[model samples]
Target chain A: MRATTIHGPFDMRVEDVPDPVVQEATDAVVRVLRACICGSDLWAYRGESARQPGQRIGHEFLGVVEETGSDVSGFRPGDLVVAPFVWSDGSCEYCREGLHTSCPRGGFWGSVGSDGGQGEAVRVPFADGTLVRLPADAVSDDRLLTALLALSDVMGTGHHAALGAGVAPGTTVAVVGDGAVGLCGVLAARRLGAERIIALGRHRARTDIARAFGATDVVAERGEAAEAAVRELTGGQGAHAVIEAVGTEQSMRTAVAITRDGGAIGYVGVPHGSGTGLDLSTMFDRNIALHGGVAPVRAYIPELLTDVLDGTIDPSPVFDLTVGLDSVPYGYEAMDGRTALKVLVKP
Target chain B: MRATTIHGPFDMRVEDVPDPVVQEATDAVVRVLRACICGSDLWAYRGESARQPGQRIGHEFLGVVEETGSDVSGFRPGDLVVAPFVWSDGSCEYCREGLHTSCPRGGFWGSVGSDGGQGEAVRVPFADGTLVRLPADAVSDDRLLTALLALSDVMGTGHHAALGAGVAPGTTVAVVGDGAVGLCGVLAARRLGAERIIALGRHRARTDIARAFGATDVVAERGEAAEAAVRELTGGQGAHAVIEAVGTEQSMRTAVAITRDGGAIGYVGVPHGSGTGLDLSTMFDRNIALHGGVAPVRAYIPELLTDVLDGTIDPSPVFDLTVGLDSVPYGYEAMDGRTALKVLVKP
Candidate 1:
């Protein structure tokens, strides 16, 4: 089998790698049907992350189960599934409390303890707790190709931001970026009953997608202009909720500044640590509630999968470009160069 | 009338100033029965604040209504009242939303547009909003003093912390800081139905007060030890709610650390600008919610006043020392030297 290996900054190549088989009783082996590059993957591509050399990189995917260990009961061969970026045991104390991101016994792929999904076949630990089975029989190519693949990572992440920010019915929400995750935030806010969804996007194509995802308004401004535009749309009262999908200082500040005095702000972007200078006083004075962390993607995947199945949300549209496992390097480059919003790779 | 004036950082003076009278249609003149030094006042006293020179310097007091403008109807001459430190007009959108501290036309005493309360007589603006009328008949002793004087600010602030933190019955609560506000937090937590109250206090006297105010456990450690102590008391789950009463980095971190995942951390102290560097990743990862500010003190005074009148909670023990209005400078020195947790000056 061939795997996408990270050699150095902006240097990736597909190399022949040993195939994976289930090692744990609760594990399963999946044949990758689709996998893709995430925005966070660019962090490593740019040498901005602590990822070591030669590691397989992808975490978002739709795969078909090829084999399962004896202890794996709920899933079997030939079933299509979506697994969250992080694997969890689903029974730990943290998992019980829905903090699956901090699951004690669970290990994240591509970072520590296990090989990631950026290859032809990958071992999935905690299969029962982590994998969401797709609806039987009607897994259409278009449905499988939907932006729902992003739900395995980015879309789930955007939902985390929306939930953490307390987006609810009648709330006005401002999303800070137009990336896939941010576009998903616009969708998540719509699903969560947001009345007014504003997407701050500079990209025309992505902004149009955001509108389709339920953004009632779109602002092409950044930083102060973006904040001012949001405030103006909100009648100078500021948004009731803000989802900060960009990890830059300007995005974070816009998230805070565009929120009302007692509103909520949630950030899910993997921050670059560039904007370390947060005005703690201003946030403090506003009495706003701040809550977010890396998304417990596994915890949200089931609901998102259901939405994908019912055709309530078409997350598959984000896969505007597709390539083969041999072209994973090109996929990364295209996304890094903004030539593609997302790239789906067929193994 | 005599007043406590902020000359500069580390410089304060007791001087004769012109007696105040109703200056606005919504203002009232109060003959201060007692004025006190507050922990927040120390910010200006130490010259760390941007307060200008020669300004009246206090925000907590019990006083008698001396006169009122033609439009001030709810308050009249001879009424004993507890004044909200943050004066509001009770009509602004923010005020209507129960955010009197952020009211556009409102003012916080001795900090920005309003005069301080540390004097014989202070002008209490927005009388209908700032002054909470006390019961007509009162026994003029320690209990009445505790209920009236302390409830004027610190007690209300403590309630704000518990409320902002969303404390409810049977919730485990951790309070950081040993000042009057922290002690009041303990009391407020009890009033809000907390089943377990762990107070982190370094001072024996303050800890004793915390215990008296219904803290179930007291930890004498400042930083890590205090957090450990609270975690131990909580059976390693950490507190469901955390009330932060100290503005230093250590206190903020300790407060953030001891709060359980998916918990609320509310802070009420005047923040120092050293930048404690909030772990946004940690905040996001834990799903912890942070809500705080200067305390919408004005918004809460009415309910607290009713509690004080009904003998539900006594907060007067915080007034550990008292002196005449002429001794305002000494009161500041006493609080600065740690000789008095709070100082009340009578007109």
Candidate 2:
């Protein structure tokens, strides 16, 4: 089988790797049908996030089950399914509380000694607990497939940001970031019934998508100007809900600054810098609520999936470019170069 | 008139000051009937928090309105009233959102050039916004008057903590700090129907009050031991809601550590140390929500006043010592020396 592998910074390649097989009673073998590159993957590509030489490297995918172990009762061969970025035991206390990312027994895909999702096949542990089955007849629809594939990460993550920030009917939301996750956050806030959605991004193409995703206003400024623009748009009160999808110190600061007193910030961006740059004193003085982390996408996938299937939201717009297994390296380069909002790979 | 004033660190004095009179159309002159020393005041007493020499000091008090300006519509002469720590215009956007502490026009009591609560009289700005009227009959009951005084700060502050942490029926709550606010937090959680309340404090006397206020368990441990005990109490899942009433870095850390995944920590303690010491990375990975700040006690006073008047709660137990106006300096010493949990002052 061929899989995406990294040998160093800015180096990606598709090479022959041993095929995955069900190794435990709770495991299942999934033959990849569709997978995509995540913004987080760019960290490893740029050597910003630590990665071993020649390690498997993706965490979002959807595929058909090719084989199942004895204890996998919920899925069988030929079933179409989606896998969340992390795998966890279904019955754990944290999982029951809908915080799958905190499950002690859970592990991430593409970690050392594990199979990556950007491959021909993946050995999924806790199959019954991790995979959500999809309707088989819809595989012929490419648009629906892309939207469904988004449920593996971005869409659900955006939902996490919205839920964390307490987005609700008649609330005003400001999303800071122009990436696929931020665009999806705009969509999620809209789905949650936020009356006013403000997208703070400088990119025209991305902001266009944001507008389509229910952003009622767009602020193309950065830093203090961006915060000022957002505040101005919201009548100097800032947004009731601020979604911080860019995990930089400045972005976090902007998120806090533009949040109204008694409002909340739902941050889903993977922190990349040295410090969070969170001014607790300022946040304290403003009565701002800060909530979010590695999003528990699995907990949100079911609802988002229902919305996707019903055509209530079309997250497929995020996948502006597509590639095949052989061009997986190009996909990484495209995402890292900002040439693609998100690259869809049909394996 | 006489008022409590700070001469220097560890030096408090009750000195002669000009009697207050209604100065603004929105102002009212309150004759101090009851005033109390707060834990936060000790910050200035210990010189940890900056204060100008000879500055007036107290923030919590209840009094009788001696006079009202022409524009003061909500209060009049002879009316019994309780003043929240801060004065606000009441109609600002932040105040309307129940975030009076963030009101743009608001100012703290005893701040430089302002009249302190621990005085014979105070010219309260925005009388309609800062003071909640009490029944005329409240003066006859010492215990009820003490509880009403608590409403001006601790009780309402504790209620803010519980509300911020999202405490609800069937939720398990943990309170850090054995101070008046933390004890009131235990009572607030009980009022909100929390199924199990864990009180963390080392003081025997305070812990007894915690039990009486509905603490189901008491953990006298600090730091790691405290976290371990809380986890054990909740089957290693931590508490659903954590109230952090101590402003030190360790107290915030403990609140975060003992919070269950997907749970929240409501911190009302004024951050005393140089840095918050919050590990955002850890909080992010664990999905812990942090919400709180200087409590909007003014917004909560009306609700709490009802409970105080009806005998539903008695926060007066926090007042372990009593002193008269001339003895205000000694009251500060008692609270600073830890001999008093809180001190009630009569002028």
Q: Write the per-residue lDDT of candidate 2 for residues B37-73, one digit (tens) a residue.
A: 9999988999998888899989999999999999999
TM-score of each: 0.95, 0.97
Candidate 1: CAPRI quality band: medium
Q: List the residue pairs that clash in candidate 2.
A: none
Best by DockQ: 2
**List-wise, what DockQ does each model earn?**
0.56, 0.62
In model 1 chain A, the worst 10-residue window by lDDT is A271-280
lDDT of 2 by residue, A278-324 (tens): 77788888898999888988888888889999999999999999999
lDDT of 1 by residue, B1-347 (tens): 78778888878887888888788888899887777889888877887777777877888877789999999999989998888787888888888988888788777777654567887788888888778888767626656865677766898899988987879999999998888998899999999999999988778888888999999888887667777888888878689899988887777788778988778887887678423735666666676777777788777877877787777888888778878877777787888898898887776
lDDT of 1: 0.82
Candidate 1 chain B: 10-residue stretch with minimal lDDT:
B273-282
Q: After TM-score superposition, what is the CA distance of residue A21 in candidate 1 from its true location, in Å?
A: 1.9
